[model samples]
Target: MNVRTEIIAGITTFLTMAYILAVNPNIMGDIGMDKGAIFTTTAIISMFSTLIMALYARLPFALAPGMGLNAFFAYTVCTKMGYDWSFALTAVLIEGVAFIILTETNLRDAIVNAIPASIRNAIGPGIGLYIAFIGLKNGGVIASSSATFVTLGTITSGPGLLSIIGLVLTGTLLILNVRGALLLGILGTTLIGLPMGLTTFGGVAGLPPSIAPIAFKFDFTHVFTVDMLIVVLTFLFIDMFDTIGTLVGVSTKAGMLRNGQVPHLKRAFMADAVGTTIGSMMGSSAIATYVESASGVAQGGRSGLTAFTTAVCFAVALIFAPLFLSIPGSATCPVLVIVGLFMLSPIRDIDLDDYSESLPAFICLVLMPLTYSISDGILIGIISYVVLNLLGGKRRKLTPTMYVLVVLFILKYVFIG
Candidate 1:
């Protein structure tokens, strides 16, 4: 409708999602991975992902490297498994290409249909809580205080005070229907935290770290290694499903779904697959559609315009890596917490009356935070879906695909455990 409202929608979407760009790299850094290049490459892919979603797919949703998969890429691939980033990148590329083929062959649709209803229900709030958890972890608001609990800072540290101010300001702005409430919430918190020295903008003191922008030697000589192929392919599908779930949700909200299904699903799938391929080639992780665009949808955006705006913002942000690199973790935490709060609003519509729906959803939602794994949440939800269906005297619900998933889930849980 109004041009001003549209601009605010776009900007808010960017801010809510921007935390991923910074946090993903930091998480990688903890595992002794390449933080500098990872962040830089991530930002660049986000720019491309957004453009494709907006201009090509023509969806209001923005795409980027998803968080859950990034942790897997860094920790599982590089650290625990002892695989080089190059070989992992090769797996990412293979998965991306395979994803494209699946979409083209209409196999992606089959996969989506194969998921049980209850498991599908779990994805929404599961991702919301997951996003919030990552936000808290990155913002330093919820640090490990004890074995089983977290201690809050006393309104002093950057994250504590900013989160407090952000909650208030973002909440108030949302109430006021302020354009870009999410972005303003973050900016407002940053401003409030500034005088307190919590949101200090570290001036360019240290010489900016330098390395080749894209440094993986095209040596896919070990692309066929069994272990590397397995991990990479797994991550590829992980990213793909997460992205698809987010897109379906956002599209439904935008009323872009035809017959309750995405019409141009193939195009959207291709964009995600291609984005992931390019990301790894550039030495980043699996790029996928972001649920953070829900922040944009919440602000009244319903067109691809928001995605285009987010892409443009990311592209513009690349020139100022030195500046973005300096933002205090607390400053970003408030934005993330508020966005999580916004994302959680959809939980009200869920029909918890049906145990079939309620059981899997509860499992998936809680497992996300408790087990600290996205895939784990999905697995629990899937298992519960099958269990609930069978026990509820609906054994006919278990398709061949469901049986396969059940066997796979059981084997995975046993082996991984």
Candidate 2:
């Protein structure tokens, strides 16, 4: 890549990925997370994810602790189900490691191959809905209620209006294929909010003047416990498949993958797995490839430089974490809706050859929004695949891993419930 072009690509990449660094920790904290650990972990994991993409994968991509999974870690695991942060974070770490192994073993490919195309189509929309829900929840636009909806912060407030404006502006930029659209949208909105008193401290995300936050006390010896391993194993698969889907979609956008081959797939995946492993040690949530950056990459990014720029930006943003907190959640909402739109682009190509594939794909597409859970949507889609396969009289079509997923699904229900 030309140096100038690389710089531009890197800048764009940074803008696209930076939001997660400032946002994920807060979202994760909503589930009983100790503030110190959440901030430290979120920052460090984002670094690892970016570095892996730049160095190992050498692809112009980025990764992080997925937004949806982190919320579940907080609300479902730590709060509702009563698991400790240790268990939840440990689970994230486990999932990451498992993702690594799965990518290495080619088993991940086997599972992806097993899914019917219809369900595959559904994954994008499912994920889009999941992401949109996350945005709303974080923005305080939606609150949980008994068989009903609740609103926390209303759009009528000044803060709410600024946020909504930011979202609209961000979404517009994305649609226009503007460079550094995310950064511009956020920065512009935050600046705009200052005059209106929507921003607390001039709308900049900055580190506290005192010492930056740190993580929980380390227990290095326990890193190898059976529980840790199991957690890592599960996340590994989840993150692995998730990234694959993203890579496939993004590669298609960039014309990087022609036919069945995506050049540098192995390298890209390796970087992500290594990033995940690095994340756990840093006291953060699991790290995995972020497909959303594809929007930036698709626009013209073409080298690891793009990802490296993103990582550097994340580190810079961490120094301003406190200011980052001041930006109203509503401002970020538009980006979420916009991203939801971008992610939805892949749904057009899903194969609807038979009900077996079509049914699961459609179900997966709808369930992400309805269940309000990405993992749940994926699990449901997987289970549906197996059932549809058997029902269609193609029992052999179910892979061994699919069977394992079925068994694990049952256990997850019995145990998690």
Candidate 3:
């Protein structure tokens, strides 16, 4: 591979995804994790995990703690479930170990195939809406109402006004096909927020914070509880499908798929599995392959060198902890809203003409944002899909695994959830 081109491609990919550096810390910090420590851990995990992808998988893909999964860890598991962040970390660790086993045994596909295509397709968009809602709330664009349950915030001032301005600016950049649109938007918003007293400017560069307080802080006391099982399974399901989707989509774009099959697929899965496992120990969420790697592939990245270059970039980013940590939720929240738009693209692929499929998919998509729980969306989606299809006389379309999932979900609601 041409070194210059590969380096450029790698930088391109990193810029497209580097917003995660600020956003993940903000999300996890909500649950009382040290933002500085999370920032360091995020960079470290991203650097090494992506290194694994480069050397072991020999692919031009990058890994980082994922977006929606982090939200679930902070909001659903910790805040909503009333569990500590350590409990969520332990669940992530278990999920990673389970993912490694599944990948090694080649049983990942079996589990993937068992889920209905409609429900599978719905998960991403469901999470998109959920994340977008969080962005709006965080940015003061949405507010809770005592009478109506929710209402519009004062969009003309404060964080709300700033977010609206950022949204338009960022949307314009996206329309112009700007590289690093999200990162640039965050910086621009932070700058704008300065006069409004919304963004605080800390010193730009500093030594990375110590991760000692959060690292290896997993709580395994609840490992045998049903709640832990649900959390772990949710983590596995989202990461597994999301990684596979990214690999397939990016590889297809890069012409790396032979006969509609991704070469070195197992190795790629292993890299993601290992990343998640290691990331938990570093006190982060489930690490997964980023679909933004498509930007690098589109830049003609074709070998492991591109990923290696990206890993090096993350390593360098550790020194900028102060700059990244200073970014306010108002600045990063707009990126979340935009990412939600990106994730919603898959909804176009769903066959809306079929009620049996579309109805459950619609339920899955809506429940995530409304219920504020990704796991609940998936669980209820599967249950409705099975019940509707079976009663609608389309029993042949139901898989044995789907049936099993429905029963388990029902028991979860009845017993634990």
lDDT of each candidate versus the true structure? 0.69, 0.66, 0.93
By lDDT, the better pick of 1 and 2 is: 1
List model 1 lDDT by residue over 259-288, tens digit each.
Answer: 888866778888888887777777777887
Q: Which prediction has the highest lDDT against the true structure?
A: 3
**Which wins on TM-score, candidate 1 or candidate 3?**
3
Please state the error at residue 129 of candidate 3 in Å: 0.5
Task: Sort the predicted structures by lDDT, highest score first.
Answer: 3, 1, 2
Predict model 3's lDDT versus the native. Answer: 0.93
**lDDT, residue 328, model 1:** 57
Models 1 onward score TM values of 0.78, 0.82, 0.99
Best by TM-score: 3
- Expressed as tens digits, the lDDT of each residue in 290-349 for candidate 2 is 776775576577778888877776776666766666655565665666656766765777
Least well predicted 10-residue stretch by lDDT in candidate 1: 202-211
Clashes of 2: 22
TM-score of 1: 0.78
Residue 203, candidate 3: how far off, in angstroms? 0.8
Report each candidate's C-alpha RMSD, comma-separated, in the order given. 4.4, 3.9, 0.8
Give model 1's clash tally. Answer: 0
TM-score of 3: 0.99
